[model samples]
Target: MKIQSASALFRVAGMAALLGLTVGCAPQTQLLSSSSVDRPITLGLSAADFEQAAAAATQSMLESGAVERNDGKKHIMVVSSVLNDTMQRIDTDQLVKKIRVELLRSGKVMVTTAIGLNGAEDQMNTAFSELSQSRKVDRSTLVKQKLAAPNMSLSGKILQRNNRVDGNKELVEYYFQMTLSDLQNGLAVWEGEEQISKLGSAKGTSW
Candidate 1:
């Protein structure tokens, strides 16, 4: 019986070792930084593409005389409708977020999270604003709330066009367009467009 038990233990150990060896032979996967990747794998849009578009648009907007203020006060801005007219299913945030971060870093425009075209970008603002109505909450802690309206409204659209370059290669052009409008006058203060074109195999759609 001891000999049989010893033999079973040896078999289990051997199986585990074999399993470990198989796992080790499998392909390795890892995370890659988007900034480090300069080449696109397909005609589809990538993080690099988004970064490029954001950089171009933000730089142009800043250079445009529209954002300049003699009052030395940062303009409060709200992100309005950013429509994705492309063929791919894309969250417009992929483009808008980078632009927002860059603009905030520039310090010329301050974005209000409490206001948006659909609703409050941050729902916490709504909840806090309603804290006075909660009977269970202490009234003394409630601060008088006043939300600032946006000085400028930001809106944009992403568009795509595809054409056959050859039997195997197709050219895809993507346009990232943006506009900043002064809320007071209802006119566009700045408009920018960044175009990225790529030629690759006409395989599947842009991921």
Candidate 2:
């Protein structure tokens, strides 16, 4: 009886240990202290600011006649690498896609998906290949009409800097820089940079 009792107690202890382990492994949400919660956070502008800046920058580049001057005829363009060097993680392609779409809508530039960082733009190449294969035209004649080469390539980088005045407040600055490179000459014919700064508490308890 004593041995059975000891075994039961051991089982209970093991179950309790398992329960404790499971609770420890569970996800936890931390409650911020009042001081941390009360810290000030301010943006120079709201989300609208980022969106507007991206749109405006893209528009300025397209309207600047840079594309027209390079190609003479409206030419195909491919957006190349964009490096993000900001404190906050952001998908740089969001800005790139916006610019690509805007350029397409402007009817001033055609973006060739056939050529991209990874071989070809998936959808464009797939469609183009299908059309070429299924077309009834003589293959030699089709080959003579060369696929349009990209006249310009767009690429750039984003840079970030941070400064802390005291233990509490911090300033973060970001710069978005982009360049339109003439593919023929391998030169950056146009370049632009936009800077944005924000001030906030260090702990991210606020904002």
Candidate 3:
């Protein structure tokens, strides 16, 4: 009877140890939080002005009605490189992407990712060919067809200027410009620019 009791307790302890180990080895998820504090913030140009400029530019192009469907086909567009001449590091692609999205929403323009800076847009093919062994699949048997070339391309740049006054305030102005070019003629059919400015005191230092 004593031996049996001791064996039962040992088995129970072993099972409990195994369960504890499993739970300890399991992955755990952590939660994080963020906070923001209000401080003295000023803008040389108001948010309303920035929004109005963007809206006006978009409206001007739409009202012009210069962009039209390509004989019942979606107008295709490719993205070109953009130059940034600004004091601050900005992602020019973000601005261009917004324009692309708006154009797409209007159902007037389609973007082509198959064409790129070096000419062909499909990097997957080049990567596969460069591999030691060819892993090319027979596309002839594939059902889905490739898309047509784009009819237009989009490109743009951002420029900035900074002015410092005797006071603690500094004025920073940025210009966002974009161009929609006709792929056939290589001429820009539509161009737009939006400017944003901000004024604020220098942080952690005196003027």
**Number of the top candidate by lDDT?**
1
Q: Which 10-residue window in model 2 sums to the lowest lDDT?
A: 36-45
TM-score of each predicted structure versus truth: 0.91, 0.64, 0.61
lDDT of 1: 0.89
lDDT of 2 by residue, 1-207 (tens): 999999999999999999999999999976654452444335333344455557777777866768674445686798899987765566787777777888888787899877778777666555655656765756665442245689899898878787786888877777778899899899987787788777787765212
Q: Rank the candidates by TM-score, best first.
A: 1, 2, 3
lDDT of each: 0.89, 0.73, 0.66
Model 3 clash number:
1
lDDT of 3 by residue, 64-141 (tens): 675786588778888888787865455555555556667778887777766767665566644544453434656554
Model 2, residue pairs in steric clash: none
Candidate 1's C-alpha runs over 4 A off are 38-40
Best candidate (score: TM-score):
1
RMSD of each: 1.9, 8.4, 9.2
Residues 181-201, candidate 1: write the lDDT tens digits. Answer: 999999999999999998887
In model 2, how large is the Cα lDDT of residue 203?
A: 65
